[model samples]
Target: MDSRDWGRFLLPYEQAVEELKVKFKTLRTEFKSRDEYTPIEFVTGRIKRISSILEKAKRLNVPMDKLETGIEDIAGIRIMCQFVQDIHRLSALIRARKDMVVVYEKDYITNNKESGYRSYHIIIEYPVQTSLGLKPVLAEIQMRTLAMNFWATIEHSLNYKFKEHLPSDIKVRLQNAAEAAYQLDQEMASIRDEIISAQQHFEDKTHLVSRVLNGIQDLYYYHRIREAAQFQLKFNELWETEDMWQLKELSQELQEALQRAKRSNS
Candidate 1:
């Protein structure tokens, strides 16, 4: 096919990618507001690859118009996560969505690819409304861990750099890197509980800091300047600890002190 035919086939896919990006970004914001554990680091989309598209069209003797709808990955989304478990959660999230209907699924994470690629893929029929009308399009979604994504990305780049032919040494290195990525995921999963506990502690400490600052702001309008200065000094001293647990304990003490001061003034 010529350049114009390529453009014609790719334009709808590009639109689909843009639509998915906007939808996913909005979803992220909504999830954050609701305090949901959305582990999607990023969602990326692309049309079916140009080279693949051309090869398929030639083999099938199909026109661009017929090929566009026939190719499943003309529009695709890749969801990058931090853990293997998150990939399952993300798949559930997508499957549960009323707007996006799952058409097919391929669990490459469980089966794994011969090339050592590990990702969970789902193809969904996503309805998008345009100026013309509502159109149901096929969107391929891939969910994988950050480490997995890193390995896949590097492998793809190397393949492209070597013109789809890699030296034996490079291929071995790529395989080793993929193995390392798998090990990294397992290691991180092992510490998942500890990591989550630390995160919760940090979040609590952040909330305590905000509360302390607000209390200090309120005191400026009521408490004596000398008392407020003493309170500020004590908070600064606690802040210097730089330990979330310690800071949290100190914040509780400071809150009690402020309450006592308020009672004494009253």
Candidate 2:
């Protein structure tokens, strides 16, 4: 395809990647705000480069007209998780989503590749609205733990450098590294509950502090300077002591104070 045609073709894929990234990131934020243990650590996405797409199409004997349907990963989303089990959780979440429909899935984690590559790949059909109409695009979502991603990143660089014909010694080393990364993920899973508990505690405290501050701001806006200052001082004390219970109490009190101030003004 010419440069102009390539740009036109890639525009929708680019939009799909960006929109999916935002959706997944928003999911993380929602979980954090609710003080819930989220399996997803982060999300990233990209559109395959034109050159890379062409190379793959040529290798697979895909016609130019069939590129859109043939290239399942024209738009790719990578969801990184904290634990191996989290990968399954994220996949389930994706399956439950209404905006995208899972066309198929490959369980590479359960059945590792010969190269020792491990990840959960899901192909989904995502509908995007355009000036013409709603366009259903095929996108790939890969879920992996942090360790898996790290190992995969290095291996990908080497593969590119060697053009998929790595030296035998390097290939063995990469396989060993992949095994090590899997072991690391397993070790982390052993203490997953403890890690999740600590994270939830931190998120709860953050949410409480945020609510208290917002209430204090509302107090100040309503000409309740004295009450706002008093609550601010209390928040500082509780925050310094890391007293979540007292902070929760203070948040409730501030909310009440703000309501009373509003009522009095009315």
Candidate 3:
């Protein structure tokens, strides 16, 4: 394809990329706000290389129109997650979207490549409004955890650096690193319950502290310094108590004290 033809093919691909980015940004905001899962970390799109298109066309002796209409990977999206569980969660979210229909699905995580590459791939139909009206287009979505992505990225770089023929020693090293990544994933999964329990404990403690502090500040603002000071002194002593159970008991006592003060003022 000439430069002009290549530009024409890229225009739609670029537009589709922007549209998907906007979609993902809205989903991220929703997730932050407890609105939705939208478990997509990132989305990327690109037009196929002209040489690749030419080669495929030559190999199959297909017409330009047939190639463009049938091939879906001309536009792509990549979703990144922090944990492996997030991949399954996000894939379900994508499948549930009314605006997108799943055309294909591939789970490379379970069936990792010989090079130890792993990820989930999906093809979804996204509608983009054009001068002719709504045009349904195909886009690829890849989902993987941060570790998987890190491994794949390094592997890709190595593949490019070696021009698809990496030295056997380097290849072995890369495979070993990939195995390490797999082990890390397994370790994290095994500790998932303990990790979540600790996280919840911390969040609960944080929430309790915030509530107590805010109440104290309100008392100080309302000319109730005596009560506020009492709250501060009690909390300080609780901190020095060196026992979490004792701290909980003290916090409860302070909460009751604050409630009494509020009732008296009212």
**Number of the top-ranking candidate, with TM-score as the measure:** 2
lDDT of 1: 0.79
- In Å, residue 168's CA in model 3 sits off its true spot by 1.6
Candidate 3 colliding pairs: none
The C-alpha TM-scores of every prediction are 0.78, 0.88, 0.70
Residue pairs that clash (backbone atoms under 3 angstroms), model 1: none
Cα lDDT listed for each candidate: 0.79, 0.91, 0.76
Show the lowest summed lDDT stretch of 10 residues, model 3: 35-44
Q: Cα-based RMSD of the predictions, in order?
A: 4.4, 2.3, 5.0
List model 1 lDDT by residue over 199-255, tens digit each: 766766777889877777666766557766776887898788766666667567667
Best-to-worst order by TM-score is 2, 1, 3
Which has the better TM-score: candidate 1, or candidate 3? 1
Count clashing residue pairs in model 1. Answer: 0
lDDT tens digits by residue: candidate 2, 50-122: 8899899999999999998999999999999999888998888999999999999999998999898999999
